[model samples]
Target: MLATAQALIGRKVDIVTSSKILAIRDASNDPNEG
Candidate 1:
């Protein structure tokens, strides 16, 4: 996903890859969240 983001923006991205992931919420289908 990080690679994709960098590709879209055409720049290096700074992210906390070592940190523990807290939550991943998928609200794609929900209109309110989207």
Candidate 2:
């Protein structure tokens, strides 16, 4: 049960990190926003 919980948390972290990276990329791509 502990391992499963760890895996779930890890997946959520990965998703959040990915979305953050995409947001940064999008901001960089738009000159008006920067």
Candidate 3:
């Protein structure tokens, strides 16, 4: 799952990973989005 996320976001596993995770969750939970 981490590998998949890294590939999708083109980011490395580091401190910012947690923030990126929150962003992903927020995007997924947005009702106004697809």
| Off by more than 4 A, model 3 | 1-18, 31-34
Q: Which one wins by lDDT: 1 or 2?
A: 2
lDDT of each: 0.53, 0.63, 0.69
List candidate 2 segments past 4 Å from native: 1-18
lDDT of 2 at 5: 82
lDDT of 1 by residue, 1-34 (tens): 8777887898965443443442233334454742
Highest TM-score: give the candidate number.
Answer: 2
Q: Write the per-residue lDDT of candidate 3 for residues 1-34, one digit (tens) a residue.
A: 7877887898755434458778788778976954
Give the least accurate 10-residue stretch of model 1, judged by summed lDDT.
19-28
6-34: candidate 2 lDDT, tens digit per residue: 78777532223458778888778976953
Tell me which residue pairs clash in candidate 1: none
Per-model TM against the reference: 0.29, 0.38, 0.35
Q: TM-score winner between 2 and 3, please give it.
A: 2
Error of 2 at 9 (Å): 39
lDDT of 1 at 24: 30
Off by over 4 Å in 1: 12-34
